[model samples]
Target: MADAEMVRRETSFWRHAVVTVPAILLLGLASGWVSNSGYGNPWFDGLAKPQAMPPGWTFGAVWTTLYILLGVALAFILQAPNSGTRRTALILFGSQMMLNFLWSPVFFGMHQPRLALAIIVVMLVLSIATTFWVARIRKAAAWLMVPYMVWLSFASILNYEIIRLNPAS
Candidate 1:
């Protein structure tokens, strides 16, 4: 019985991962593409960038890795037995993702850095809450989310610096 249960749980995790990883990748890529974010965008290219900014290729690479990590974290959470903790984690995760999807549009499509910054701040907070809630159920799941939070912090700094450099923007 124990072995069967373990196998079932493991299968559940993989099944969720198969759905999660690709969805995250697609949604993230689509968000960036729809907004025309990054180097090719004329408005973004014209803005003064922070000195610490990485090359154009770096964003895609780092975000790809981070999104994969986040997807795995989410899969782990989803695989856990349903409960209030899991529900809270899922809520936080969905909320953060919504804001995540909104950021590119608000910043690049709408040209509103301040509002985008606010959205990022809230997203980061929700991500942290999700991490903590996931931690209550699965330590490894929470561990997977750490890099995302770290990257979000760095991205927030970059966003702030961009707004500071181009107050007119």
Candidate 2:
């Protein structure tokens, strides 16, 4: 009987994980697509990008992977029961995600690298705070965000450099 109960609990846990993970990933995908729309080709090619700018393909690959990690982190957070801290963490996560979605459009579509850099700086700060809050709920979830933070750090540098190179942009 104990073994059966354990199995049931594990199954339920996995079911929740499945639902939450995909939902978060879908959010990321939708955001990315919305931000990238009407911003390809000449608009992107026209920019005076930094030498360290990754190729277009790299952006797709990296974001896909990062989104997966983010989804997993959010899933871990959702596994926990409701609380004030959880609410705050979720809010922070949503805010940073919104900021993340805004970046591509501002930098690529609108050709406003300086503004994008500022947005990214805000994103970095919010992400750090979110990660810290998530850590208080689930250490694993917080750890999962570390790679994302690292990526954002690199991205901020890239954004700054783009602004420097494309002052007219």
Encode model 1's per-residue lDDT on 1-169: one tens digit a residue: 9999999999999999999999998999999999998889999999999999999999999989988998999899899888999999999999999999899989998989999999999999999998999999899989999988998999999999999999999
lDDT of 2 by residue, 113-153 (tens): 78889999999999999999999988988998999999999
Clash count of each predicted structure: 0, 0
> What TM-score should be assigned to candidate 2?
0.86
**For model 2, what is the alpha-carbon lDDT of residue 149?**
96
The TM-score obtained by model 1 is 0.98
Best of the candidates, lDDT:
1
Every candidate's CA RMSD: 0.7, 2.6
Instruction: Provide the TM-score for each candidate, comma-separated.
Output: 0.98, 0.86
- Candidate 1 error regions (>4 Å): none
Candidate 2 positional error at 80, Å: 1.0
